[model samples]
Target: MPFAVYVLGLAVFAQGTSEFMLSGLVSGIAEDLQVSIPAAGLLTSAFAVGMVVGAPLMALFSRTWPRRRALLIFLTVFVAAHVVGALTPGYEVLLATRIVGALANAGFWAVALVAAVSMVEPAARARATSVVVGGVTVACVVGVPAGALLGEHLGWRSAFWAVALVSVPALLAIVTSVPDDRPRVTAPTGASVAGTGTPTVRAELRSLTGRRVLLTLLTMALVQGATFGAFSYLEPLATRVTGLGAGWVPALLALFGVGSLVGVTVSGRVADARRSAFVLAGMVSLMVGWIALALGAVSPAAVVALVFVQGMLAFGTGSAMISQVFHLAPGAPTLGGSFAAAAFNIGAAAGPWLGGLTIDAGLGFRSPVWVSAVLMGLALIVAGVIRLVRSPQFTKATVA
Candidate 1:
């Protein structure tokens, strides 16, 4: 409901475009830098690795700072990274810039999530989270595609410049709109602690060690790994396996993004009350969708429709899992978000690597679909165990 939440989402859109637009620009970058295509793709992996390491580290480092100040620092670094990346003459410099940008992006998301949830009432937490995560869905739909188009027409560096330009307005918005952190609380002994109610780093980390919190983080990782694994190879799957022309690749990607938009929006409405059931159903449906896609890869119609379906299910599950992390670890808001961010990025990194391994092993593109299905199946088992453990009957039996 607060305007600052939307501004954070605006910031996410800019950074997320940079995160995904590399998929479209890899070829151009490879050619321009005289690097192999596979070498160019490592840029994406570098960003993912940075996010996995940065979220918690950045959150811990900035935990004592005012939220507004931390956000400004992160976004400013992100914009500057893009500018430097755009002007880089060699692949090594560009790769370093991507890692730097991802670190900033991860920090922004970690803090922004905590800030967004703090601004809203408990009952509206899921809705508030969706508003933040919605930026990624929108970026997938609009920003990445537009970035790709810009790279196609104006060279890849121009796409980088565009992300920097778009982020400037978000930087200005944060300055004007986002509130500074509240004052710290003083204990009876006159020691000051964070206003966030958590007093120490050890306590913050301890809160995340609970069974529910750890499981929720794992579920997030599995769902994301499954989604990205299949998604990373959709192009080859479409052109080679599904027999679609290269021109249809963008359309398929757009369709998947549209489905993600719808999925996250719908999940937000009901996730506050039905987070467990929603995630379970989503993973189940997503597994089935992947299985279907694998079986019917020869049919172009099936591949197209199934990609949309899987996108909806995957993103919907992802958004719900994020809120679930907050709900599970109520004592460590920022750290919980950081843990979720780290989990998702870990999956984002692992998925493509595993998918690539399957391809390099001479498994066809359809093999990635099967890999996604297997990941989702494992995720479903995790979600099911959580659901079972939390059931009223199970608790009563455990007490006995």
Candidate 2:
């Protein structure tokens, strides 16, 4: 509820908008650049790669700076990267700009959660982190759709210009609102200062390596892979399976976004009140079931309903997973959190690629949904095993 949280959220909003708007504008970018759609799609892949490479690198390098100062530096980089992206003359140049932007993004999120936790009391940590991540949820629900409309109506370039324009205010907000508190703990002996050395980050990573965190992250990767695999080809699926025209695709995506927003908001409260792992596991199980039903359903209405449900379960579990990591590694939360973020993006990259292969193999759009279901089922088994391993008796008495 602090003013600083809102400012951090705004920064996150700008970053999320920039990151996700590409999917909606891919065709526009391809046409304008006179390149194939697949080629334009590489822009997205480039960004994901940037995040994977940047998250740990930035965290390691920034390990020594004060949390507030580190965030400001990253936000400045984020804004500058967007400005460059908006003005770039060629596709290669634009791709470079996106990569820089993605790196800035990885650093921004990594520090934001650490900063947020430091700012609030223990009981308020989940809610505060939720507010920061809420920006991404809002981006999916509103920002991406609006940017897509702007790109379609004006031009793809106009969308980046708009992002650049928004970045100005976001930068100013971060500069003025973020506190000047130094991180309470020092970095590890060999680690960088801005990197995760806080008690939370360390504890979470230790827990992550344990049965519970490992299974939780594995479940997350599997569920996200399956969901995004089908979701990446949603337009085709909507067309082929639901018999809908091209015009309805954006609306359906918006509906899914709405589900994600609701799920993310609800998950925080659930994790705060109940067992985080239990909530995560339940959501993952439900998501798998929904995917199967959506794939089999004959009616467009049924498919739409299931899509909404999928969004809810996917992101709801996401919120729980993040909070669980923080709990497990309360000493060094950001490293664990960043690793999880990396896992999510890795899944993001893999899902579309896998889905494309299935489509190319003549398996039809629905086949990806089945693939996702299988992945989710695997995640469920992983989660159940972790639960068994972490049971009270097991915790008190080790099997080894």
Tens digits of per-residue lDDT for model 2, 1-400: 6888877887888888888899889998888778899889889888989987787677756755776788878888877777777677688888888899899889888788777766787677667767777788788878899899899899888888787777678677767787776544444333234543454345435555777666776766776787687777778878878788888887888788777778777775666667565565655666556566555655788778877877777777766666666776544555665766777777777777887888889988777777777677777777778778879888778854
What local distance difference test score does each model get? 0.88, 0.74
Q: What would the TM-score be for candidate 2 when compared with the true structure?
A: 0.90
lDDT of 1 by residue, 1-400 (tens): 8999999999999988999999989999999999999999899889888999999999888877889999999999999999999999999999999999999999999999999988999888888888888899889999999999999999999999999999999999999999987424334333235353444566667779877788878888988999999999999999999899999999999899999988888887888887778888888899999999999999998988998888888888898889889888876766888999899888887887788899999988899889999998888888878878788998899889
Worst 10 residues of 2 by lDDT: 188-197
Error of 1 at 217 (Å): 0.7
User: Against the true structure, whose TM-score is highest?
Assistant: 1
- Candidate 1: regions farther than 4 A off: 183-196, 391-400
**Shift in Å, residue 113, candidate 2:** 1.6
| lDDT (Cα) of model 2 | 0.74
Alpha-carbon runs more than 4 Å astray in model 2: 184-208, 277-281, 392-400
Please give each candidate's TM-score.
Answer: 0.94, 0.90
